[model samples]
Target: MNFRIFKYLIPGMAVILMTGACSGNGANGVNGNAASGSSGPNSQAPAGKEVKISFWHIYNTGPMKELYDKLIDEFEEAHPNIKVDHAGYGIFDLGDKLATALAGGTGPDLAMDGIDGGQLKIKAGTIVNLQPYIERDGVDTNQYFPLLIDIMKQEGNGDLYRLPLETDVRVLFYNKEAFREVGLDPEKPPTTWEELESYSDKLTKWNDKTKLLDRIGFAPNLGNFWYWTLAWTNGVDFFDDQGNPTLDTPENIEAAEWWVKMQNKYGTKAFSAFQSQSGSLGFDPFVGGKVAMEVSTNNLVSEIKANQPDLEYGIAPIPIKKNNATWSAGFSLEIVNNKDQAKADAAWELLKFLTSTEIQKRHHIAGNALVGNRLAATDPEFMKDPDWKTVTDQMQFTRFLETPIEAQGWGGQMWKNVQAAVAGSMTPEQAIKTSQKETEDLIANYKKTS
Candidate 1:
């Protein structure tokens, strides 16, 4: 599993308030729980024979772990004869262990991992194609975001390989109090790059005598925001139509330069020193009123609520440069190919219950997350919340990053290059050019083997 998945999947502290609300029918118009007699191949445990399936996942702690345990207890009660042997591990450890187990033909029947890792397993033939089971159960794939479900389909054969668990979009989080303090209207936030720069200037504070920044109005590389997000906003794709890396294109170079400019305005050394202090402060700078604005996902709500519930803030669409765009990414659940037909069926049942409309709604409300199931997100009960409305409304401009398989580990390398540019070790053009060459070489090596 990716480290990013760990951040997104952990439920907020608010979830503890909704622990009683997990049971409900699926969005597909069927009961999501096996105890409700939902029609499916594994809806009921095999007659006169007990069946067991193993489930492993990265949600090892926090409210999410507790929520899953509660759901599992209900599942076992509903299907008296079917047993689930489930365990949790550190995300990286889980990925390593899962790979080793699959190689040894002893992997669990069901597991959860980052979408890319799941895709790799699918290509390797260790993960099961879920299309047949989806068809058998009449699951309404239409209920999911088209982009999300589309990505799950195999490139050539269109076989669905994994199911998305949660989806999220980036948003601009501004401290309303900071806005008031800076003489900017609390209701008006920056909508374009120009405005963001101007607003940030006013919102930033400096310790005049020390010639150091007291606070940053906006930090381009901070929080969950990624450099690729700016590339997309500027209408540049990481790759060309030929599936080759295009990181150093004119458009991308411009975007990287803009990001570098923002860092330079604060003086790299002074900014780096301030950032180190902020980290030692042991809380999100936004929640601590140290940053006037931040680009982050809805999950930041959890941090605010947990640390300083009284902080007033506003959420808005990300400021645009060349286009109105943001990226969505999330963790997904996958079923491993099991030789025992009964175990396979049982794994599907567990998956169905987790994604059902009722459970998905609970997930959204409890965790402040955007679920893959559109029905769950748009429910009348959840739609009433303004924060949910803000995030979901931006879904129209949201898109998934479509990295080609040949460039599987490209992001880590790209991040290092981007960091070098931000820290002033290299020029933006130099960093992007170096990344472009490295990524192209990666694709070439993959082609030689594949």
Candidate 2:
């Protein structure tokens, strides 16, 4: 199996590849005969017969794990015929374990994971096509955010293999205290690239004698900042309509050059040294007051509340250039390919129950995550919080980059070129050109072998 393809199957911009081989567990420990039925809201299993479906997820700890278990219990109570054998796996271990299990025909009936890995499973023929079930059950795809649905259909001839579960959108997080200290208006955040640069300069502090950075205003690579987001903000798309690499476009080059310039301004070595110091001390640069502003996702709000509840902070859309766009990514629920039709039907029932508005709202509140379900996302109860409202408001402008399967390995390769440009080993134009050629070569080679 090509693990490179699975490595990019992460939930968001951060990619972690699990290379260790995992051993399979048989039938997820089923204890009873599986029962088949229509997957409608009113569907019920016959008396004296029960179906057991195994479910695997990465929410292994904290409130999310507890909430998941509680939901499973509720689901079982509502449909006594369906019993779910829920299991938790480390996020890093899921890809390899799932791949191994599916290959051995011992995988779970249903799984929730990032779209990237789900795509690899689809390509490997290890996941079921959910279109038939969706149509038969009259599942309304309209209930979900359109972008989430679009990403799920990007694989296998536009077939819907997974249902989006939750998602996060990137935004700007600023320390209001830092802005006040810098003599800038605490209520207003930078709205444009030029304004952001000016604010960053004013907010940054340095020691004249030691030549060390005292505080950083913003770092392009900090938190969840992705070069793709920056490029998109500058009116660039990394791929063309035909799914070809378009990294060498003028707008992309400009974005890369701008990032490198920001790094050079603070001295890359010094900036990295400061970042290392923060990491080594177990401190978040932003939360610890080492950095005044950062580009981060909705999750940062929870982190801030947990780490420094009293910190005066503000959330705003990421400073933009050509458009009010931000990058978005999230997880989806998929039913693994199974030989037993009964187990497949049971899994579909569970999938619908989990994605239903009430259940989704409960999950979002318990986890403080942005759910993909429109009703849950727009619920006034959850949107009452200012921070969440600010994050959710940008959904209309959020964009999801659908990477072509043939170019699955492009992310890591492109990051290397980005590093080269940041280190001054190559110009931004040269870096992008090199990355484009290498990606095109990779796609061509993959096609020949596939």
Candidate 3:
């Protein structure tokens, strides 16, 4: 793992853990704490007891759900004494559902959640620490990216609370046909902000008859690219050591300015009109041939394949600024804090199986997504795909974002400010400063009420 990458992973951990203090489930929660401290590799239930543990994950549809269903069947067949019952929830609802269950003194033996959500569970003292098991079994932690391991640990304590299942990185995707049509080299995508701007100018197509943009080369606001991503690439920390919003930092302001500049260059009225039409276009602008390049997740490749298999496109590292940086976030598997030692042990067995290199590789082959296991990511079969390889190569510079529990809805606010700036109602500095002040106020208000 690169040092630069690790630097971004845990910066918000301590601050995140400090804000969300949830109550433990029940008397069972005490047993959960004790198990983390005492459990060893050899700990087990009586030979004939037969442990049954339930797992709830967020993969209710598509290939991931199918893969999980298939893997669960295999797991049960191999360990007849252990019965694993699993269920899936919609992605947006699982975290809230898990929180509700824990508050009501019950939860699945195991569940899947994002690092930010998992940290809240850790702060509540209702997540199992896997460190003891790892130490006793001599599991090589190096098999995971540093951020995956880092995000799983308890703040100010070395206890690990979760194991990652899937991870993703942002990258630049461009249409090769568009590059050739513009007389630019399709093989050489932009590697810097200056080059991105230069290429966008060359690739953009204007319609004089309608005075509209027939083809947009690139737009800062397009795709999955966020304002925070640009800020991170330019070495801007969204929060300070004390967890205060630093949205108005010079680098952040510069990033905002650039975004607004692009909107202006494309003609704000025309840009806004085009965006409105594109949103209702029923397909990705890049896939629909309305945009030439986009910054998006690795999963976008599958989207392209599904919607426009004949399209020629290429993936590259997102253009860099002061640092080579990309943002990532993933789902992790965690054992719920409970009284049943046998149940916890069973959950651990399932965890190991799910994150194993073989399972991770199979999942990728089935769904075209990245998994937490480094060995699986580097498998010869997966490495052969140029797009997959391009994405995996970015793992070295990838960083995860941690949102403070108190600032749950801040993203919606920040994005509104972004729209205001890009629409020219606010200057870049004003937009960022206003967002900073509003977010700070949000945190301050929560602190006062708590």
Give lDDT for model 3. Answer: 0.76
Candidate 1 deviant stretches above 4 angstroms = 1-48
Give lDDT: candidate 1, residue 68. 79
Q: What is the lDDT of residue 3 in candidate 2?
A: 20
lDDT per residue as tens, model 1, 318-349: 89888988877776777766455577677887
Clashing pairs in 3: none
Residue pairs of candidate 2 with colliding backbone atoms:
9-116, 9-117
Error of 3 at 71 (Å): 0.4
Candidate 2 vs candidate 3: the lDDT winner is 3
Query: How far does residue 62 in candidate 3 sit from its true spot (Å)?
Result: 2.3
Question: What is the lDDT of every predicted structure here?
Answer: 0.73, 0.75, 0.76
User: Which structure among the candidates has the greatest lDDT?
Assistant: 3
Output the lDDT of residue 228, model 2: 75
Q: All candidates' TM-scores? A: 0.87, 0.88, 0.87
Query: Ten-residue segment with the worst summed lDDT in candidate 1?
Result: 1-10
